[model samples]
Target chain A: MHVTSSVRPPLITGGKTYADVTEDICRQVEGKPTKEWKIAFTISVIVLAYGTACLFWTWWEGLGVWGLNKTVGWAWDITNFVWWVGIGHAGTLISAILLLFRQKWRTSINRAAEAMTIFAVLCAASFILMHMGRPWLAYWALPLPNAFGSLWVNFNSPLVWDVFAISTYFSVSLVFWYIGLIPDLATIRDRAQNKVSRYIYGTLAMGWNGSAKTWARYEYISLILAGLSTPLVLSVHTIVSMDFATSVIPGWHTTIFPPYFVAGAIFSGFAMVQNLMLITRVVYRLEDYITLEHIESMNKVITLTGSIVGVAYLTEFFIAWYSGVEYESYAFINRATGPYWWAYWTMMTCNVISPQLFWSRSIRRSVTWTFFISVIVNIGMWFERFVIIVTSLHRDYLPSSWAMFSPTMYDIGDYIFSFGFFFTLFLLFSKYLPVINMAEVKSVIRSSSEKLPAKVAGVAKGERVANPTFNKDAE
Target chain B: MADLHGKYLVGVYDDDEVILHAISKIRKAGVKISEVYSPFAIHGMDEALGHSRTRIGIAAFMFGVTGCICALCLTIWTMGIDWPMIVGGKDPISIPNYIPVTFELTVLFTAFGMVGTFLVTNNLGPGVNPNMFDPRSTDNKFVMAIELGKNKLTEEQISQVLKDSGAEEVNIKQF
Candidate 1:
């Protein structure tokens, strides 16, 4: 059944020691890159250079240089924004939310996912700034109140709301991620082989030592932050959804957006995780740490969220049809049967149908097959945004306002450049930072003993339980 | 250094089931466990550990309420008191009209307030680093710690107590 390989830590029958896990992860940094890394890095650099040149050109010109007319004011810019933001959501979801839920399986991939979130958000913000026609005047989006005195900025605009939400999310996620990195950085510092490595690692470590007392407060604060970050993570996407929901656009103004967008964000985020993890596990031979069981768990989330998004899709259609507003009805109908029907169906097949395969045990566990499906999930999400944005806007209230829209090479270039920006940061993370949470992995190993008596009071298997130990010696 | 001897308590378990079991035994033994240590997060440990429902939600409620109030004040001051511009055929302070701004204020203030509250409650900011123990505590281990008061035994007695309670390794710290 290949179930054994799926359980991973391959032959963890005796359970892997903490030292083994640390040694396994540290091997990548301690050794030279495999042949594949050299090739991949070279390609990424070239692509990154292309992306930089595109950005320079975009800045030299104006947002009008792209194909965005007044009809499709957002075009690839907002699509890329939402896409990258969606990509970033999985980071805090995996690290912060999963930590709050006490999901043991999350430890394997949370570090990498959080790194991806930071990079993806950076990419997303680049789009936002670049899309600002007058990039120098982008501060108008902030709440500084126009200096030229064109009346104080409305406090109610979702566009302004997006500024706070995205910025807060970026900062909070960065803090959450860095706090988790402290001990692992110390681990690298302690074990570093060279003077330069030691100096760099030490600075990042911020003088951490393994004392039991400090750990007490650290644990308390982490729990609190996890609590804080869970809602914050949820809020980031909810606010992002409001960016569309508050708008009077035919397809955008729906109550279903918050939950639907949240689900889709997670769905796409996990898909990206799968994409990166699959290649990483294969290339770095970290299948032991990033196991098939972990993939299955993530696939389960992807599938569940995908199904929720599917319901949202159908619900929007149903609501629009039932509302009997011709414009609204036209939006859905045009999406499904119009010239861009290919985009809509592609969204459905990739995001909705591809994930449904996880309903089967076999499909979810097959590493190779899951990787293929993850690509489909990514493509589906990107197309879904395109369908939602372009289809609804191409034709508005009157037939006289209708016009067909197609992305020019400029549009395509800007979209592709986001990938360049995303990967460049990602490659840097892979090269420098500890991609896995080493401390957490060690703790997992320490607590994996089977000899202890079974069945304590009310502690569930694999769930986050509070600490329960009293000192009789004190009493 | 501080003198907090023999007061700290911890129960160690190898697996989740044992963690739950040890929790039961420890509770039954009338020994208030300062902490429970495990390799992974076992479910329901918070209830087992005697932790209160954290005030984070309450703080969020307060933050959200503050936002609503701020929105009200800002609208009253800016639109009602200041030069009222009747641009959209509506009163500035009207409920229907004020909703969008109110909502935005609610989000903005709640988000910022929650962040500030969180930072303060956690005792986090620049130049204030908390002491650390077992660098591994936040990593892979699920631990519950309780620092003891004045009454306590010798390190050997405490060590024996922890070892009997299934602690894999029992140690002491005087701070």
Candidate 2:
């Protein structure tokens, strides 16, 4: 397997030193914000301000502020919640799944993706609180004893399960992200020139000395954490899918929902990662680190998972017809030909058909094409959630009780508010932390142009120079 | 730097392979190495230094078991005993339904417990002053430090051993 070729593609394209890696990442934090960063940060802050205003209005005014009726109790709120939760999945999949599979390319992008997971989950949890109407009583979802005669949470309910799953997922992701940052934080700490910066980076670094003993344990802990996170990522999405599956709603009650949702979660998750990565690569001027090869590899994943999600769409219909359940059959038919047919076709075209273009190597390799398709795919996934929710709830078993669901100004505002929250946190994260993992990326640098270790001048003069070929093999 | 203790001899190298080679050579010569630091982890360096494997996985597994049992007991006590009100015409104590929460908590406890164990074992956390041998160790250099007071050999002998092991630069450090 040691095929030393002149054409071997380096993950880090530019010949870079460990010092360059540190400067590339730490300068973004230490230096003043660039003009592009200033513009993006301002937009995010404005969006957040407006969104917070809408949420305050919802709080002061009540549930009537939104366009929820008796028939469609969960129109946009739950849809946005599930969408944000789904977006969070790609981050963990990139970090934990790729690490487990020994995909070394993830070293360049995993830090940013994990940050995305944390922010996306935060946006998702906000919807749950807002949907509660009385947000102050949000803790009731927890399995806690109450003052009124020991009324505990209902264990059989999926909503209660959601509280545990989401809280656990959020906390675990936070710890995992923080632990991975320690070594890099130490790099920043060592490079700090000012007193305040030294104190901040030093505290975050947690006194890492980078000893051989410490490095060994750090690696062991990382592996165990990766193993732990694999199942947790799958479980988080599975439990979220259960929220719909356990219900009696015709479109919602399928055994296929778990796998189907997981696939779609990954599909959309990669799209968002691509979306953010494209902007980051350009804004941070990091084309050498996040090469077009990286983008193409991610597009390959988006295409693969996107196709799986498409197959899931068809499988749901086939099962609906094969089961001979009239309600299920009607639900499928209505989704295609009902008043919301536009949304249905949009989802199919974007998620099912559009990503098929990636099968072409030229399109997959093109940054512009990949970026355009990623955005379209994200739009399609959002519509998929909307169609599932609105199409199912809008129609009733009795025609007399049937009603159409439409979003009010408040609904639109709340959805926009989530974007504001997600972007705001993401922008801050990019500016404050190393956008790429410095320590992990340093381990992957194998450029032949790197300076070789020289032999000691006296007794070791004739000894063979150690070039790290075996080090590369062990890694 | 006021509380500086014993003098430390610091050896610097540019590559991990040289450090690994030097570690084995120096250890073979019977010089005690206090620690080796690098910008990135050099695989198998611990084994070269004869350090044993870490056991943090055991702590993780035990923490997971505790989470699973605690989750099950809570589900049973609340759904089957404390307030067993039937909803959706299902059984009060539903084992399958409780699986999600159980799994979630198990993962949660495992992750947090392992991280805490790592911090305590490594003596790492905010406000803990780090023992920095050289600032460039976090840059493009690898550093191996040997304490003069810890080893039976004199400082000059250890410095000679480091030079023979292919260290590019050897200097005396105080911290």
Top-scoring candidate (DockQ): 2
Prediction RMSDs, each to the true structure: 6.6, 3.8
User: Model 2, A384: alpha-carbon shift in Å?
Assistant: 0.6
TM-score of 2: 0.94
- Interface Cα RMSD in Å, per prediction: 7.5, 3.1
Q: What are the DockQ scores of the candidates, in order?
A: 0.12, 0.62
How far residue A409's Cα lies from its native spot in candidate 2, in Å, is: 1.1
**Worst ten-residue run, lDDT, model 1 chain A?**
A1-10
lDDT to native, each model: 0.69, 0.85
lDDT of 2 by residue, B1-175 (tens): 2332567999998767678778888888888888999988877787888988888889999999999999999998888888887877878887888898999989988999999999999899899998888888987789999887777777778889998877889998887
Instruction: Supply candidate 2's per-residue lDDT for A77.
Output: 96
Return the top candidate by lDDT.
2
